[model samples]
Target: MSTTPLEAGIIPLVDAAPLIIAREIGFAEEEGLDLRLHRAPSWSSLRDMLALGQIDAAHMLSAMPVAMALGLGGFAERIDVLSVLSVNGNVIGCSLDLAARMRAAGYGFDFVDATAAGRALIAAAGDTPRIGVPFPFSMHAELLYHWLGALGVQAPQALRVVTVPPPLMAQAMAAGEIDAFCVGAPWGSTAVEDGVGELLLPTTAIRAFAPEKVLAVRHTWAEAEPDLTRRLMRAVWRAGRWLDQEDNCLTASEILARPDYLNVSSEVVERSLTGRLVISPRGDLRSVPNYLVFFRGAAAYPWRSQAALMAHSLAARSGLDRAAAVKAARSIFRTDLYRQNLRDLGAEMPGATDKVEGAMRDPTAVASEAGHLILEPDAFFDGFIFDPTGDE
Candidate 1:
């Protein structure tokens, strides 16, 4: 049996587990794919690699495809999101100096409660808070804007936004280049390990069930190679399902900790997998359920509403027309492709392609083909629900 060789780009982060697992755990091979993983230095480089046909697919920021579709980010290539790879794995942390200031100002670092955390972050950050995100068009930036803007900070205007790659975030903090950062684990956990920063809040505290990363490919490539696309999606989907199982955490962490992959300690990687984080140098432990969701509760489903929300944010910030942006962005999340690939594999899929973003407050059962799809809580901290159809 001849396997099709496919190259994919990824950044070194815990959320890259699905791609790593698909290769390491034999899922990709099972699907007749010779999956080759390339670790890029940053999100921008990875995005460009995919754009330039350097890689067939990528573990990409969810907002990247949408931002590209909206004509932001200076990339004109169309990138389609095949499926969501991981959901809600980001952490907002502050430098040791900022943490001390926040602590002295009576901020408890509760590691939840976005509203209180936002207020305290604002007060402690003074007039203009210097914050770091992996990319300007990433969910980290969008959530930061949404979370802080809701809490009376003007955001992006009243804040100094810095673009630091995930691997370099801890170094940026240690050097006092960034006052705070919102990044994916185990990079955030790495900062704590390095004694440079303390975790303040998981992005889940801002918006539960945010689409963090997607399995993305060039739109032209997906269309040209439908069979390969289908095979790749199924392979990664299987890996995500396996990752969500509690028993696989140890093995998955070990695989991800290899030097070829994330290259961090398995213990550090496992913390993100299990949602148990050591937030501070003093070792304050916080357990957050569903912190880095891989597959449960339709986490891998490519919801167009999620894309619309990201598009809405990008448009509002970039001066693009909201309606046009949403329309373009929603099409990029390829739910049709997801169904075409994974439906026969007993993958439970939501019957609807889009939903009111941030509306679910609990594990609510929705209409699905399998009749057992219960969506996890997806409410925004401020209780804002975005109706993709009702953009007025």
Candidate 2:
């Protein structure tokens, strides 16, 4: 009886729940991956470890692989992102004053209207608003840029974008070090709960399928250990499915709140998980359900629309050509690996065929009534897997 150790890095956010749960619930062990879960304090810390193969893999941001693939920032290598850990788990939170300014400015504070508020924040802050995001290359920063630019408000050189850990987001908001923050769950909801800030937008408000965290591996490692990568992806997919069960939200929240994981209260975690979001009980915000989702059937699969968006985002940010950026995006966002793992696992699957599109159709439309099982549409997008190296 030999234990095969697979070292993996994780960050302290709910989006990392899939990796943590896969380890804690025996899925990784069953797969013969003796998982050694190490906590990386920040995204850069996690990225460096994965880039250098210090850890075999990491729970990462959806944009990270794209940015790294395009050499957007200081990340030197072309790393590959094998799978998305979770999608649409982020939110935009602002100080009470910032929230008020938004209302006074006549912009609805949901994702669809975030462009207005994001630009308004930049305009109101003028020289600098001292905004906080987890990491520069993470989805938070990319999304901030998209939302701001959508309103014709470029992130001027004067606007400050700082890195703050998810746990510290609440304290920073209370201390007034940051004017607004775009962060993963618990922290954003925690701020409003404590009267330190107000919830501005549920991330789903803008794009329902925004990619949050991903399973990132060194490009070389993925090429060398295809079996290990498949095993890892299967474990993640299983863990994701396990978390999606309606009855499992409470249990999953407990797992995530342990000191070794997210280290947040179960109450704070639940709000994000079940959409019991308390959007300012006494204020103008409204509470909503279906907030945080580990698995929403086909919603969990790594769709290519998200990959293209990441490509476009990295290109826009780094001033790269759009075609080259899309090519970079396809390399890492591989659905073939995902499909192989699904077949090996004998898991019930969505019937997503080779078609690639910006959005996936409702799985319920094609699912057989016997199992109530949802299937991703066959040819869901137009020839989705044509080239893992795109811009075609």
Global lDDT of each model?
A: 0.91, 0.71
Best by lDDT: 1
Where does candidate 2 stray beyond 4 Å?
103-130, 155-160, 174-177, 281-290, 346-392
Which one is best on TM-score? 1
Per-prediction tally of clashes:
0, 21
The residue pairs that clash in candidate 1, if any, are none
Q: Against the hidden true structure, what lDDT does model 1 obtain?
A: 0.91
Candidate 1 TM-score to native:
0.98
Please provide TM-scores, in order, for all candidate models, with all chains considered together: 0.98, 0.83
Estimate the Cα RMSD of every predicted model relative to the unseen true structure.
Answer: 1.0, 4.7
Q: Which whole-number lDDT from 0 to 100 does residue 135 have in model 2? A: 82
lDDT of 2 by residue, 219-277 (tens): 78888998888778878878988888878889888998998887778877766777656
